[model samples]
Target: MNTHTRKLIKLNAREGLGVSIILVILFVFLSVSSEYFLTVENITNLLMHSVFVMLVAFGVMFVLSTGGIDLSVGSVLGLCGGVTGWLMMNGTNMWLAILAGLLLGTLIGAFNGMIITRLRISPFLATFAMLYIARGLLLLFTINEPIRNFATPEFAFLAQGYWLGIPMPVWIALAVFLICYFLFNSTSFGRFVVAVGSNQEAAHLSGISTNSIKIRVYALSGLLAASAGILLSSRLTAVQPLMGTSYELDAIAAAVIGGTSMFGGKGSVTGVAIGAIILALISNGLDLLAVNQFYRLIITGLIIIIAVGVERYTSTRAKTA
Candidate 1:
């Protein structure tokens, strides 16, 4: 590898090492503690089920890297999935329905961009409002009914089919991971996002079009959220209005745990992927150990705090170093 590529690998390693170690430790502990944890079936299920949050986390990572947050992704996922299912139920072509659903998500994200850029609303508030609006629209559209029995074989294959003896969701997640890794690590768009997050005013003064960057990031966030929704619609035969409720927590937790700073300017796609795996492990371990599922939420919250604190400490050390 060239010097720059080597340095990047080192940096990503440095940032992601702690979480990686944690993942290994967790994996070993769970394997020893539970007979069910290390089985091929259980392991595959854990990884497969994690694709939804993992997909959403990838989108949220870009938004977080831009020093912004998107609270609407969960709702976006629900709405988009509902839309796709509803369309298919109404006899719309599967690919066409999926396209419309994806377009809907992208538009919602673009609208988020417009509101934040034009109205000067904080990202938190803008997306928070959008969360409710999207959810409400979904409820009205579905009449709070579950959209069921719309699964076509092609649609079903995305989340349910296997290739090379591995699950399709795992493959999809891997493809997304590879694509995002390149974007975050090797592209000008990535550099611009970090620059804008590092200092919006400086980026603007440097002719970076800060607003445009923010808009695109939000749009990307929406598209990815919609992707997760589409996958969910494929996996499940039904789409409920609130099916994606609170998934933003998982997305944020994964991004933060992966060493993406909430204060912005830094991100690692590999880190986010590892973080998602860690989360999946935690939940699976809890289930295997017969722990109350509510404890999972508490554990997730604690992880977020610890991740944020670690981020702060690491940032301080870097500044001083």
Candidate 2:
């Protein structure tokens, strides 16, 4: 590879390496601190538990790559889950309900994309507005009550059951990562997203349709967020309106921690996955160590700051080189 290509690869690897190193450190710490931490069951539980966050992170990375943020993902997730629950409880077909939920999420994403691109509003503001709007709709539709799942036993399998000794949610997350990996690395549209993120005027001058790409990116983010909601609802057998509150922050943190650029034009699906795992490991290990929840938040914040700072340093060095 040429020097420029090698530098790009190195930059990508650098973003991901922190999470890998942290995971190993956390694993060793947990293994020493708690007998249950390294057990097969605990490890399975940890991976299973991180499924939702990981799924959200994968999609968010794409949005970030286009220099956009979607604060509405968690709210959209809650709204989708609530709709799915409401439909199933009223004797709707499970398959149709799931599809409808996903569609709803896509529409929500499209709306955000439209408002941002057409109206020239900042994506941050547009998605932030949708966050409140979605949350309000979720609560109103559910009458402020959790919607319990009354669907067939088969429906529960999607979220809680395992295939080949692996939880379905984790498999779903893996599928999400794989799809995003291809979408970001192998698709022309993905190329446009990066191009626009790097320079909107330049991309437009080059005949790329930046607006359409932004809309698609946000829509995909919504679809993934809906998937997360659906799986969580299935696992809990209920859709709680407040279920995904603050989850957007967690997903964004995971993406940022994984080495995705907040300023856009940079990131990877794999990096986001590693970041999600690191976040999960931190929470899991801390719980094992009986650390305070408040302290966990503080530590998470510190780690994000350090990660971003390191990324900034490396990015600057890469530019200088």
lDDT of each: 0.89, 0.86
Model 2 C-alpha lDDT per residue in residues 1-321, reported as the tens digit of each score:
698798888766665666566667778978998998988889989998888998888878889999999999999999998898889998999999999999999999998999999999999999999999999999898885568846569889999889999898888888878888898889998889888888889999999988999999999999999999999889989777798998899999999877788888888788788788878887888888889888998987887787667656765665675
Error of 1 at 111 (Å): 0.6
How many clashes does each candidate structure show, in the order listed? 0, 0
lDDT (Cα, 0-100) at 151 in candidate 1:
93
lDDT of 1 by residue, 141-163 (tens): 88855698999899999899999
lDDT winner: 1
Deviation of model 2 at 226, angstroms:
0.4
On the 0 to 100 scale, the lDDT of residue 293 in model 2 is 88
Model 2 TM-score (2 dp): 0.94
